[model samples]
Each structure stands twice: as C-alpha cells, then as structure tokens.
Target: MIIVIEPDSDVPIYEQICNQIMEGIARGQIKPGHSLPSVRVFASDLGVNMHTVNKSYHLLEKKGIITIVPKSGAVISSPQDFNESSFNRLKDEFKPLIAESLVVGMTHQQIQNLVTSIIEDFTKNQK
Candidate 1:
C-alpha cells in the first residue's frame, strides 16, 4: 500500500499508481476482496488529481484486477475471476518483453532466473 510517486519520471502519474497497486497485490499487501481508498481520499493522500486516481482505478478494473462499485468503492478481484483468456492475454503481452530481453543478449536462463527471483521476492512472506 506504500506508493512512491516520482513526479519527474518518464512514466505517467496514473500508470505509476496502477503499477504500485498491482505490485502491492502481488506482494500480498493488498489481499483479494480488499477495498481501496476512495478516489478523492487516495488522490489527496498521493497529492495527485482525483482524475489520475480514477484513471488508475479504471485501468485496474479493465485488467480484471479490481472491481469498482458505486457505493463500496474498489475491491480487489478474486483469483477465481481469472480465466484462460486472461492467461492468454498476459502471455501475449509478455512475448514482446521476452523478445526484447533476448534481443538485448540476455540468455533464456538469465531471464528465467530474474523472473524466479521476482516471484520469490513477492511471495516469500505470503506462505
């Protein structure tokens, strides 16, 4: 739930928000069914515009990571919500990144090790 925004970074504010939220979920800091702060409150806390937070929340919703309800705010989606199409879409998205790594002279083993390390770092405390 700790999100640091670098105003001077190349990434957009809304993307930074979305990435941090996704990372929080991956690290188990934000569990499934957890409710996110209201857009107004989150924007106030992050010192960003409410529209930025809204855009981030909507992006997360579009990716099936969270559900936005009118009165209840945003809730993390459960694992059961993911399906084969989601897996395929994610695989397709990763393809170019993997290809880029290879083109940069990164060996397959090195890429796999990096992925493993990241997964371990994120899930270590969950169990």
Candidate 2:
C-alpha cells in the first residue's frame, strides 16, 4: 500500500496511517487473510515511530478491520465484517460533507463520474 503523510496536517500520524489502511481495505488493494507489515518494519519503512504504526494497527483491530495476533502479525479481516448498517452510518456521517460538496460546485454527475473512475482504477489495480 502507498501512503502519503502530511506532517503539517492537523490529523495525527497514527490516524493518517489508519485512514490509509482502511481505504486500502475498502478498495480491495489488501485482501482478507493478507498480512500487513510488522509494526516495527512498517514504521521504519515510513520513517515514523513504531508506536505510531502500533496505534494504527490497534485502531484497525478495534474497528474489526484487522486482527492482531501475537507473533503472527496483523491480518486483514473478511469483507463480511462490513455491514449495510455500518455503511448507512457512514453515509449519515458524511451527509454534511455531501451537502458541502454540492454547494462547492460539484455537480451530481461530476461526483458520480469521479466515484466511477475511482472504483474502476481501484479494481484495475487490485487485479
């Protein structure tokens, strides 16, 4: 997975990592049963503190997106873990942003087109 971190951003580094990991799962770039890099190894690779990666991994585990096994490492959870109620919850959470996007000159067609392209690209990359 490719992660781009903005140090100056208000979000914490751990959260940034967590968000990217979640996005990777959502896009199917990382499949269920796939193991993620060791926390220490991933932190070293990203030039971040091990605690940062650990925090992100723990967060994923709490969210049911991953499982943390001692000595075995982190593994992506099955897609069956995600439910329609969770998606509805996410949609309700994004309601304001969806309205804001509409007000910001993003037409419905334009938004649909963008999402379609994003999904297409994600699928292509997953292959």
Candidate 3:
C-alpha cells in the first residue's frame, strides 16, 4: 500500500495514515487477509514515528477494518467480520456528517450523487 502523508496538512499524520489505508481497502489494493507492513518498517518507510503508525493500526482495529495478531502483524478484516453493532456505530458516526451537510444546504440528491461518485471512484479499479 502506498500512503502519501502531508506533514503540513491540518489532518494528523495518524489519521492520514488511517484514511489512506481505508481508501486502499476500498480500492482493492489491500484485500482481506492481506498483511500490512510492520509498524517499525512502515514508519521507517513513511518517515514517521512508529507510535503514529501504531495509533493508526489501533484505530483501524477499533473500527473493525483490521486485526492485530500477537507476534504476527496486522491483517485486513473481511466484510463478514462486521456485526450489527459495527453498522450501528457507522450510522452513529455518519449522523452528524449527514446533518451537517443538510444544514449546509445540500440536497438529498446532491448528497446521494456525491456518495455514488465516491463509491464509483473507490471501486473502479476492481472491475
């Protein structure tokens, strides 16, 4: 996986790492059962602190996107690994963003189109 980190961006480095990894998963660059680089190696490659990568991995674990095995490394989780609670958590997370979009005068159609476009962009390479 190629992760480009902008040190000057407002987004934290760990969050950027997390987002890129998630995007990689969406784009099918990293499939289920794929092993991620070790935190030390990834940090060295990315020129970031190991702690940052660890935080990102932990966050991914918490989000059910990956699992950290003892003495093994991180592995991508399959969709089947997600339970109802995971979906509920996702809904809860999206509520504020959707509400904010509506409050900002975005129409339902516009929001839907944006979502469709993002999904298409993410999955285009899979076809």
Candidate 4:
C-alpha cells in the first residue's frame, strides 16, 4: 500500500499515516499479523520525521487497530481484538463526521449511498 502525504494539507502528518494504514486494512492491502516497517525506516522512506511515524503507530495501538511488541515491531490486530468498546469508539468517531456531512446539506439517502459505496470499495479486494 502506498500512502501519499500532502505537506500543505490541514491534517497532521501522523494522522494521515494512521488514516492510510487503517484504510489499507479496510481495503485488504494490509491484514492481521502483517508487520509494519520500523518507525525509522518508514519515516525515512516517506521523507518524514521518525517521531511522526512513532506517533502514528502509538495512536493506532491505542485505537486497537495494531499491536506494538517490544523488539518485534507493530503488527495489525486480528478481528478478535474488536469488541463492544471498539464499536462504541467507531460510533463516537463517526458522530462528528456525520454532523459535518449533515451540516453541509448531504441528505440521508446521499449519506447512506456514500457509505455503501465506500464499504463496497473497501470489501472489493477481500476473499
């Protein structure tokens, strides 16, 4: 999976890295048990600071999307790690985005359709 970072974007670099990693998981370009490159290597490859990649990995760990092991590296979390708390977290994360979409005048059907299309895109590569 390739992640393109926009230096001029309002979003922080670490957040962009985290978002792309999560999106890669959704698209099946990444999966459970796969090891991510070390923070230093990843940062060097992306031409970003090592601290930025470290922050992204830690945030993903906090979100239960990946696990960091000493001397091993970060690995994607398995589906079994998902639980009710994760579900609530997802809902909480969506609340603000949903509100913004509604505030922007997106109709219910439009929102539903958009979400469905995104889901399809994410699932398309799955077995």
What is the TM-score (0 to 1) of candidate 3? 0.96
TM-score of 4: 0.93
The lDDT of each candidate is 0.94, 0.87, 0.95, 0.95
Which stretches in model 3 have alpha-carbon errors above 4 Å? none
Q: Could you tell me every candidate's TM-score relative to the true structure?
A: 0.95, 0.78, 0.96, 0.93
lDDT of 2 by residue, 39-126 (tens): 9899999999999999999988977889998899999989788888778878997798779889999999998898788778767756
Query: lDDT at 62 for candidate 1?
Result: 89
Query: Global lDDT for candidate 2?
Result: 0.87
- Deviation from native of the Cα of residue 62 in model 3, angstroms: 0.7
Which order, best to worst by TM-score? 3, 1, 4, 2
Identify the runs in model 1 with alpha carbons over 4 angstroms from their true place. none
Clashes of each: 0, 0, 0, 0
Model 2: per-residue Cα lDDT at residue 117: 89
Instruction: Write down the RMSD of candidate 1 (Cα, Å).
Output: 1.0
Candidate 3 pairs with clashing backbones: none
TM-score of 2: 0.78
Compare candidates 2 and 4 on lDDT and give the better one: 4
Higher lDDT: candidate 2 or 3? 3
Instruction: Return the clash pairs for model 1, or none.
Output: none
